[model samples]
Target: MESGLAGWVQTIGYIGIFAVVFAETGLLVGFALPGDSLLITVGILGAAGKLQLFPAITALFIGSFLGNNLGYWLGRWAGPGLQRRVRADHLERTQLFMRRFGALSLLVGPFIPIVRALVPFVCGTLRMPYGRFLPLTLLGSLIWTVGLTLFSYWVGSKIPNLEKYVYLILLVGISAGVVPAAIRFFRRRSARSVEM
Candidate 1:
């Protein structure tokens, strides 16, 4: 799955990067897509003279911003109905988190693959004011896309095994996101048990 996606991006170049990032963040089915890996690969390619770094990063920033906006609207349209039928505990947790730290979540969510895709939708469903959401979303998108792209570009420039290590970087990135969420989940569960 990883290599195939990388190959496709390699074949299509910057446009592919923009599309994949857009889809992964904007669309639900895109949750499984290799976003972090793709970004790293593109950065490596930029370093290799295969792609233009400036334009590619620019497109990535725009694509992510637009994708999150689309997701937010999509959530507004469909999230309410889905939220009603979903389990209550999950809903309560999401709502509580959103209420307490929505801006921070919006700012940081893009770096975490799963949360990247879902945060915009949830914010929309909860009717978060767009005025507040937009600035944070833009800032987060800028940081995640530009920061990773530049980091990978630097690594690719310095490393010989760009392809081999891109996956490792992605593994660390994914783990970074998952570990925190898992810790939170366990803490929440323990608190509930104590209350009981």
Candidate 2:
């Protein structure tokens, strides 16, 4: 718990938690927020008796789920218009990718940063049936909220000096998301170059 982060978490409290989680899942601008770090901090605070676990988890779950849904709806409403302006082939690739890997993407999205926000939007843009999309989003939200929150709480309680290592944890968690995306990007670029 770096004092800066700790102080921010403490100062903002639960509303801050809800807002951040919601924005991270729903809004494009939210990709830059430190959602994983914030969740872990919330967990540590819960362990320290600063915030109650049930309410915190509830807020996080609702925020994350609704946020994803909102993004989906936004995509349904706005994505087609946007897609019309872009290359048709790019749009096809997006839909094709979603068709092939939609479930996996939904299940894994919340763990990633920008991708988390993009997943639902892309799914809706691709017109993935709502039936197929909802369950996976729910499962992902549960894991992202309950799983990570509880894990951090457990670690905070067990570790002697947990504060010192939080920044490292944040970096690792973020990297888990970013590194894969980076690899995919480079691979795609290399493939295109080879084609040329």
List pairs with backbone clashes in candidate 2: 1-163
Model 2: per-residue Cα lDDT over 1-196, one tens digit each? 2476766887776778888888988765455787778889878777777678888889899989998898888788898775565456544554565567657888876776566767787887777789988998999899999999999999888875575566777778778867897999999999999999
Q: lDDT tens string, model 1, 132-196?
A: 88998999899989999899899888977565555667678778878998999999999999999
Clashing pairs in 1: none
Per-model TM-score, in order, reads: 0.77, 0.79
- Looking at model 2, residue 135 earns an lDDT score of 91
RMSD (Å) per prediction: 3.6, 3.6
